[model samples]
Target: MDQTLSPGAAADYIAAQENKSLLRFLTCGSVDDGKSTLIGRLLYDTKLLFEDQLATLENDSRKHGTTGADLDFALLVDGLAAEREQGITIDVAYRFFATDTRKFIVADTPGHEQYTRNMATGASNSDLAVILVDARKGILTQTRRHSYIVSLLGIRHVVLAINKIDLVDFSQSVFEEIVAAYRSFAHDFGFETLVAIPLSARFGDNVIERSPHTPWYHGPVLLEHLEAVEVVRAAASRPFRLPVQWVNRPNLDFRGFSGTIASGVVRTGDPVVVASSGVTTRVKSIVTGDGERPEAEAGEAVTLTLADEVDASRGDVIAAAAARPDFSDQFAAHLIWMHEEPLLPGRSYLVKIGTRTVGASVTEIKHKVDVNSFQRLAAKTLALNEVGVVNFATLAPVAFDPFAAVPQTGSFIVIDRISNLTVGAGMIDFGLRRATNVHWQALEVTRQSRAAMKGQQPVVLWFTGLSGAGKSTIANIVEKKLHQLGRHTTMLDGDNVRHGLNKDLGFTSSDRVENIRRVAEVSRLFVDAGLIVLVSFISPFRAERAMARELLGPGEFVEIFVDTPLAVAESRDAKGLYKRARAGEIRNFTGIDSPYERPEAPEIVLEGGTTSPEALADEVVEYLQSRGYF
Candidate 1:
């Protein structure tokens, strides 16, 4: 009888074999540490590559191999043309292979300092990590860096692969010394499993099979250890959380909330509540692709029909009624900066987590990590590839759990508004209780009621320009005019505020942002009281001004640009600030060392050096009156 099965049976057998438990891991080390080579050797020894792929690899090795007549296994994992030419991996390359016991997915991450972001991206979804170190140069800075990152990402299992042991003649004392050094530094990481293996990946020793070179070692081979290590399955036994990704309403008669179960389980008739709105309803049915089901577990995609219609939509979460997650508008998170431009604290970005996106800003940088030394350093802003602990403030409340409890709802991406590019990734350490504790106490007398009593509309006239741009002079005139007209008004002069409210702030870019933030918050309070607030400041950044505009009600915030040439402002030098800035006495002074971003389209523009203050004030008042402010 023939042993081979038919094509149809073979397809079924292959599909059945794919149902094995999977392990996802990554290999990270310094440049020339042989990470790609190790991954390539694993695939080759496991017989995962096809004949044509091996043939091509052999040909490529002849042309590009550093070792003559030897197969360059690294060529198999380095997929890009540039990577092949440079003999280095630039991006994260994922490869899949299966052993008889378990399936495996391995990420070969770049080892360059500039590609730290790529390494982080690979670690985000991995269950374990392999920190490879060359035995000749054991426990370098890159090894510690990779270990720190994998721990930050909450990977419990780690394998310390000391490769190139053949170069050291497979010395047991060297392997023991390196293992002891790594354990001393990484003991505080709290890894559930840490295994050390000494082998030479270039020779395929102790990779798929045990090596005779390490006669002193009694542990299982690398493949055996990988297959036996136990990793926690994601969110399977925790509280139920399903972030609503879509609202399925094909017809008027049917409605369902569709999302994959992020954690725990759900069954028909289970009591569920909306995480954002807190509306309780029982689950009427659980619908899956195969049709209605009795129950749905974590990682399963299903549509849930509620017994009663509620205000649930995309970005909402449906959780078991008895166990609901915390909701807050503020959180402390670890931010990995990924962009070339440094992060500006007050600048707003669209933060996305699960199905929701909200306007958020990094309010404060607690500290940044020095990856090389593992030391915490005080930093005002984060540059590319830097990691920092930051306080984030969102415009609206979002439901989330601690990353340790559930990763799906706790991770987020920060996208630049103008560029629509991801600038940072954040992991929510925990939500700040103050965010929910500090609630707006409702009062019978509100902004509308106050405005009605005053018989005028509340407004904030934001006057922005260079240092000597006559903004203060024009704002003073406007306040005087409002005072004469029997309207309630107040002026927040920049210099006056700096004398007290912002005394600690300086001329640095970060300090300037905070200064504007304080002024805007105070202006908001004044507007709520139904008083016209005149904010005169050289708030140079356009993003800061835009944030102020968003803080106020529609049409309440008016941007008035004081257009004055730098030469004119310099010549005037009313307070000698420009001259001092030129003499290097004042650093980060706008129109000198720092930048002054002119408003692209302002409600009012005054040629400050040419136009009279009274005229400019009259034009502002005219704009207010035209817009029905009085």
Candidate 2:
């Protein structure tokens, strides 16, 4: 594609391009802001399109082009059939091209608000962002949202591309006004460089070459600035960190830790510590696929052999002995909720950082950010595309550096345990000091010792169903039967606990999750005290039930589903609560206004409609006896 190179110099051109520094960036903005068009224009001006590709673009443009009789450059990038039909980018599209100076990989991200997750995905890997804005519509909400996400994801460089300038007759005042408004809101974004450029993607104006129409505008063109911008390489200067991805033992004689170096440099004989266990060892050898290496810096994937036989495994961070990353079970972070299902605080999720996945929950939602005003507003849950600061509590401690210092080891993704869908993304701020300060005191008397003294196995029987589904009645009978059998037992009914322990909580979804969380913790304490605890609550969400189940050891927590049809439960209306719910008097009433998620695989399924409470209680006792719970 280089015009200066002759046909005989093809190898020379290829070699020169191979050595060019690569810059990764993305184009993002509000809908109809010409993100795809700008990328298409860049590819076209760089002369990277072949004859067949150009011809296909021309044919597709005739069918789907918004610009009449003009080449629809968007067709080059909007390759999805649905995208062509809807005339909007629904997914992130990436393209590669090279100028004479630098090779580039640009991502054309979607502009619609619903596809904001896709934009965040693109921004996560990019070093710079080109945020397009319609010259007519200045500083829209989506623009601000994307800008906030860009800053949150730690992109230091931004180019405010004011597209469709020709539509506004290339007015300098319009450009200045839009730039001023954007800078006003983005003042706290902390970007190192903010460049403003005016261009019309539909036409060739200040795209690759300077335009004569903008005589008043004297600045480097888009391509010139992209090539000249220097992206900082700060990872190599930070503390040495390598998240152990795999324990490589191809043969019994070879033991190596394989992972890409997350930060800093590692050399042979360097003292490294397992961040979680505090076990120290020296690097005996650095092995790569190509052979041995003396030293490797950040971003290099190598296998490290330790001098001493120390305990190190996947999910452990190997760091410099003098400077170790922080390890904690509790921390605060900023979360970007990406799924349609709102983020509930107490529900259990799988948090994946580096190669380690742990059970985690949002302990509290501090506040959600109003992207337009940059104000923190009180929020109990985070809806789609919402950003919030939250405290996360993991089942076990994880080693991480603050995202500001080392991004690779500091960011995590939240995955739904049931669906395995990525629901949220977050960046670690810092570990909670309280988590580190508080230590678990070693008690001589343990749960096993207490249960042996009582001559019985301690367990939790959890009852969950609709409000009028006989959950409490069956659980009460089960507890009485167990007590009559000379077994130590205690009951924590939902209503009784509400009057004392959970008196301040309500019936909202968030409150229900917290309510179950508190009851689950109390049940665990009772189990530790050598008593069979019966917990009866309509723990509606399966995620919350799963959280409770994970808190206890194997076979200690038993879930009982009181299977009663909604119509039948409402027909009985034992407490007359369903009547108020049906009359719109009570809000968030389960099985009436709110939802009740049925347990997929509960330990016991009691027929509340047909079976008597005594019969159900007998059935539960028989099952527990058969399982050797006596």
Candidate 3:
């Protein structure tokens, strides 16, 4: 049934559609920056409000607005009672609007430094930014920080709204000075364009409509630019690509692949290829919500009918037959550490690229990119919130395109198994094929063979401690105790691991990370073989320890922290390594030089030197026994 939507409904529908030109924009400014007032005024002056919405605002004003100044304009969007009382947005709020020329998806970002993660969440996928800079404060640190984030997120377009012009008496010189400073500072990054507009969002000077008060300004109003500026779009003039999201099989015989076309276009009978298997097939038909299309363009979420019932499922990308995606088990990419935890090399994560997720590890961190200047600094690892160009090698082959070419196929996220949090975001840059001549072969031993050979259940007893602490001694005794219990066990001493499996690793920050990682994986294998694996290492970083704990099932990898004071550890001088570290012989050394983040909680805390190694090892078995691990 064909029906005419009311103007309000039309506006809402257009703003919500997936096919419409949605300009993802973000608003960033500190408290008292008039950011909320600006958005409120824009909605008010644009005639986007309904009578019911306005009536509710009026009643709300009369009921709770103590000052009673026409509903506190900011209250229109900041609807929370606490937000209304405090007059600040605590979280990122998404709102959509539209003018005659274009549609907008505005992400109101938080200003506080502590909420930098929230700000990044909003700006991560933004195409443009509306940086609200108070005319009085000019450009503050928060402004610079938000701008840096916008650039880092690849937001090319920026609209610098020099708000609160009323305070500056509409001073052109002040506005121009601020503009010049911002342009100079921001020109260092990939900010494609910047449009400076002078306006008072509270006074509605240049938001929805132009004001004669600012005669000196010739540019269109805020709404005018919003309606005119094109949201930088990827043209559909490339090869057709679609990552199969789901199999649409309403019946057994009839089947179809459904996904949003990420790029290019697909037409009826067009030659299509499955990315994983490299099998070619022709498109039988294109099914969309609006019936079938002769050709489906980019950004259209449509179900595709194929010529054959080939083995295709989620994660398999379908593209034009002539072109093939980059297929490899390993690849190099730039990663942005998103979680509160630091990223170290050799840590494995489930990499989710498009619909495909696979186990991946960082082989090397080629360099860290300076988001402000886009400089590629040679670094070992990327800390949280730091963007770096790092190389990752996955365990299985996956398809990818360079981020510069395909944003959808190129992007991925890393899931930390410990916290189940998305720790990083990556963009593909290089594809490293599996080496056929490398001759890398994993063991083919059965679980029965390995356990019978060892004589006991394989479990990873992870021991953490400060340098010079009696971790190795305690672990050695623990292995002996386990052997006496008729349980097969192996002592993976920290020093021993550095000489064998982790031989190539060094004490460098990134290398130490990889070192612990190699040991953890070997420990996992020991557990699989039904033998208790005792790992004694500093493993100073708490986050890595958490990862090791998560990799093992509940009570599988037992963390025993050899709790010893730093002074006590330094005084031990068992290996004289702490003395060497104090003499500047070692760099990035834990305890002596580098900071050791102690574990807040561990299964057992054995005092180093104070407790007998035999007693400590016996306690470990008792603890495991209580937990039913024995």
Instruction: Give residue 185's lDDT in candidate 3 (0 to 100).
Output: 82
- Per model, how many backbone clashes are there? 0, 0, 9
Q: CA lDDT, every prediction?
A: 0.89, 0.93, 0.79
Better of 1 and 3 by lDDT: 1
Model 2 Cα lDDT, one tens digit per residue, 430-456: 988875557889999999999988888
Using TM-score as the measure, the top candidate is 2
Error of 1 at 160 (Å): 0.7
lDDT of 1 by residue, 1-630 (tens): 889999999999798777778999999988888999999899999998999999998998998876589889999989899888888889999999988889999999988777888998999989999989899998887778778878888898999999999999999999999999999888878799999999888898899888988889888788998899989796788889999999999999999999999899899999999999889999999999999999999999999999998998899899989998878899999898999978989787889988989888998899999876778999999999888999999999999888888888888889987668989988899998765556678798999999988889999999999888889998999988888888889899999998999999898788888899889999999999998999999999887888888898888999999998888878888898887888999889998888888898898998888878899899998988888898
Which pairs of residues clash in candidate 3, taking residues 3 or more apart in a chain or in different chains? 456-488, 457-530, 457-531, 458-530, 458-531, 458-532, 459-531, 459-532, 459-533
Candidate 1 has a TM-score of 0.91
Model with the higher TM-score, candidate 1 or 2: 2
TM-score of 3: 0.74
Compared to the true structure, candidate 2 yields what TM-score? 0.97
Off by over 4 Å in 3: 1-23, 29-31, 51-71, 188-193, 249-251, 288-293, 363-384, 432-490, 495-512, 521-534, 538-630
| Residue 519 C-alpha lDDT in model 3 | 76
The 10-residue segment of model 1 with minimum total lDDT is: 433-442
